[model samples]
Target: MKKNLIKPIVAAALFGIATQSALAADRGTPREARELFDQAVKFMEANTPEKAFAAFNDRKGRFVRKDMYVFVIDDKGVYHASGAAPEALVGLTVLNTTDAAGNPLFRQMIDSTRSAPEATVRYMWLNRVTNKVEPKVTYVHKVGDYVLGVGYSAPRASADDARGMLTRAVDLVKKDGAAKAAASFNDRQGAFVKDDLYVFMVNMDSGKFEAMGMNPALSDTDARGLHDAEGHALVAEMIDKLKSAEDATVEYVWRNPVTNRVEKKRSYVHRVGNSLVGVGHYIE
Candidate 1:
């Protein structure tokens, strides 16, 4: 009886490990992607073009990890190798091709490699596992006549992250004053801009945006004219809520700055004196 139980326990442990590996295989973080990208570069450096392409084209090779895969493009915007789908994508001239968000990705990559040895670009790409487009950040390195690159999409920020960021932004406004806080909030590299989350503030009376974290150009835009992708007057509704409520959670459809896709967004708005400060997180 003890021996039977031991076999069952060992089998269960093996099953658990297999399950964990399966879960881990479909998802990868930016750090992991960068590490793999570095390893791929080293592999290419150590081997000839024939051997390097063979390793990259291998589906089960080390170059392919989780959702992260390696791709190589020539300066003329032609694909020489793609770890994900070599048969269909390799040898394709994609100079004019654009990403899901209409970003001229290959052209931009070519342009970037000409000026810098390495560069990073963020754009929307299809996550094969999710079958949906998500924001992807790729790091490209110029190697000989080919530009090798690797990218991974990050998980969108949760509702909790938005609320926590809002709390901090609110505290900053209360402590440092609105004018100073708006500057920090408008900084693209600032604390408020993370994943698919950002902070935007509006003047309740004027209904003009004072700060927009993702794009400061949207600042001074009339909030009343703002509408969601579905043409819902969401900003006007937010202003109406501020009339009576100290805090409100408004749901709307807005374009995610990271993914550049119109996605469901929920904003936690708080009335700070005459100004209304808000932070929104995209629903994944």
Candidate 2:
């Protein structure tokens, strides 16, 4: 090969390598997003406002990690810094801005911060790596006159994933007991709760909730009273199907906790002694 040709070839190879690296760069987890948020919080608490905002606004700074980035907004709902797109978002009033799902996210942040020092909000946002809108869960903290946030996109679970979770949950119940398994199922941050998929159990005798992974507050409640968006008696249907069969699959319109929308969902239920254990997945 000629010397000039060799130089251009090497340059093109380096460019290709760089592009691949960019594509392979981001795919952050919820744990990493929370860690980055905590680090940014400490940085803000230790440094002056001017220094802290500058660090947050720096896309090349430590505040920006993988797909997670620090974003700050004043109490008035004006953007102070946005590491993701500072040029387009900073210095703008985004209180009225909504997600693709029509969720009033900015106003929700302000309202949430008003009553509590910190909270988590979910909304649909475009994932740069996937070039698609997915479920985004953000951790926001109220500090002085500003609210700082960091978010990461979480993927939805498939029907097979739900079945797998249900199998593990049933195994846990068999290995340990219903009481122990119920405790694990009710744990929101535990293995039972994954993105939009969670395990729930019902007392077949009394028709009461034994465990509700996505919403523990529903535990001990009357499962029979639970109805879907279209007023379908989903739990009653499940119980009726379980009377003659070992397993039951019921479909209904339920609100997805992650997406906060009414979508078609199907739950797989099975008998574990007196309790019925189940896991559900959204159809679309």
Query: CA lDDT, every prediction?
Result: 0.80, 0.84
Clashing pairs in 2: none
The residue-level lDDT of candidate 1 at 158 comes to 76
Point to the candidate with the largest TM-score.
Answer: 2
**All candidates: CA RMSD in angstroms?**
11.9, 9.6
TM-score per prediction, in order, is 0.54, 0.55
TM-score: model 2 vs. ground truth:
0.55
The C-alpha local distance difference test score for the whole of candidate 2 amounts to 0.84
lDDT score at residue 128, model 1, on the 0-100 scale: 54
Show pairs that collide, candidate 1. Answer: none
- Kindly list the per-residue Cα lDDT of model 1 for residues 51-160, writing each as its tens digit: 87788878688888887788888888877777777765667677887777798988998899889988998777766545556667899998888889998875577788
